[model samples]
Target: MDGPRTLVVSGASRGIGRHVAMRAQAAGWRVIGLARQTDAGAPFEMRACDVADSAAVRETFRALRGEPRLHGLVNAAGIASMNLLLATPPETMRRLVEVNLLGTMYCCAEMGRLLARRRGGRIVNFSTIAVALGLRGEAAYVAAKSGVEGFSRAFAREMADFAVTVNTIAPGPVETDLIRHVPKGQIDAIVARQVVPRMAEAEDVWQLVAFLLGDAAAMMSGQVLHVGGA
Candidate 1:
């Protein structure tokens, strides 16, 4: 691509998505953000579109079809809740799948089309260490994230012909609002299992994200890189 690169980041209203959007903009990429609600102070353009809604994702991407140099997508829009499998309500599991799994799929489908049209792009989807750790009390969350990992690998293979690389980041617990409701003891236990033995910092994950979105990672696809050394 000869012109300025553009990237779309989902879940940009807060947490990891917000950080990625801000940092990517600072790095000179034209950033477009998507979330259910818009952030007034966001430095990049923020679009209100819930990724879990397939129709909303289609419309959002349609609106951005004219963007030049569209180069990447970062799917960081996700939700998590802790509950034992038996105790978890049907609605909770459905919601988890909706936002965490289906959300990623919907965005990837829309962005995948755009990237395929351009003949190349990178897609980074977020997962969780819970899936790898087989953590109890988070069966639904783990299942949803597991789907993300599996889907990314398959999607990567399919998109390879178009030079579109798909990869995943599965980070251990971070002190984001996503974990605010989780018990401190449980969080500590999860951290203790990591070789690094500490809760992840936002920067730790962002560094990997920056690389995956950069030119150096062009050959890296269908990979699940875990942070915190879990």
Candidate 2:
């Protein structure tokens, strides 16, 4: 009898991460959620963690490594900021780089190690359309997402030897709490740039996640998929 496939998703407390967790569970995967909330209230396993903190990520994955079978990972933990380069505060810059770049790196490092042993697994990461559009007032966010894209491409090749695929999904803009902070005018500008010209729903993003997690995507690696028709 085959047991349930396992997947780890960071930032699982809310936003895209939470939505992914729900979708994965519905797809019959055992989802392990990692977030900062101790009581992240969910059916699947929840590990309280701050992915930005390297030590915490290391520890969380260390425990997860002991699982009987690990099949997938989603590095969805990230932060967004909107400010001109001149106006962007140093603290915000540090946080953007820390939570977005460093967090993804740390999760990828630990999860990649475990998934490699499986000889077959999937790793999906989140990027943003800003990285491609060079959107104004998002210098810090764009820089961090650029790092994620680069890391995903390079790491895909490195992990291929182990039959593990790594890919990134860059959503134009979704109706998540993450978007509430942005100015409405700026949001409208981004929407106008998309071919779809509409807010991305949770399912819109999950469609790609499901495909990437499916066996059909075995040959798809090192790709950066743009959503919302960007």
Candidate 3:
């Protein structure tokens, strides 16, 4: 008598998070979306929660404890700023690390508990190609995402005994609002270095996410998959 298979997606108000929620819903999974700004028109259930706020994330999951079959979590919520290390303000750097790294860690901690109790689940966090390519203008952002990659690797090992798998996806120059403010030349340069010289669409990332959440990826954990060939 298990309930419906469910997924909790953060940053679902827009961008890649919204796309993942939509695709998961269309595929028949029950999706609960978390964001500071809730989307009224989203296909799945939307809740107001900022993953960066540890208390908010905890209360949100406490509210969702009724979902008996929580199958996965996708921590796609993140923020970025393209500024040199010295030029970046302390507040800005802190926000980047808080949202991009700590926020992800918070959600994983809460959801990891639920999934562990269920004895199996999936976790897909987001990193960035900037971390791999050492993109010059985004020092704070790159450092934050690099932390995500490292954290996922360690988390996967800790969660292994419970049959829970943790993985990360690093996308390059995705066509989303996250990159709209970045300079065109910067994006172009990054794309040109990719094996596939094109900005990734949200769908491109979603396909890999779908793989990681499926039975096919049961053996894949603690891996950072780079899309757009970065």
In order, the Cα lDDT scores of the candidates are 0.92, 0.90, 0.94
Model 2 ranges off by over 4 Å: none
**Sorted on TM-score, highest at the top, how do the candidates line up?**
3, 1, 2
For model 1, residues 26-133, the per-residue Cα lDDT tens digits are: 989999999999988889999999998999999999887898899999999999988899999999999999999999999999999999999999999999999889
Which residue ranges in model 3 land beyond 4 Å of their true spot?
Answer: 1-3
Q: Candidate 3: global Cα-lDDT?
A: 0.94
For residues 73-174, what per-residue lDDT tens digits would candidate 3 score against the true structure? 999999999988989999999999999999999999999999889899999999999988999989999999999999999999999999999999999999
lDDT of 2 by residue, 1-230 (tens): 37898999998888999999988998899999988884536877898989899999999999987777688999888888777989988999999999998999899899888988878899999999999899888888999999999999999999999999999999998888898888788888898899889878878999999999989999999999989766
In TM-score terms, candidate 3 sits at 0.98
RMSD of 3: 0.9
Cα shift from native, residue 85, model 2 (Å):
1.6
* Residue pairs with backbone atoms closer than 3 Å in model 3 (clashes): none
Which model, 1 or 3, shows the larger lDDT? 3
All candidates: TM-score: 0.97, 0.97, 0.98
Instruction: Point to the candidate with the largest lDDT.
Output: 3
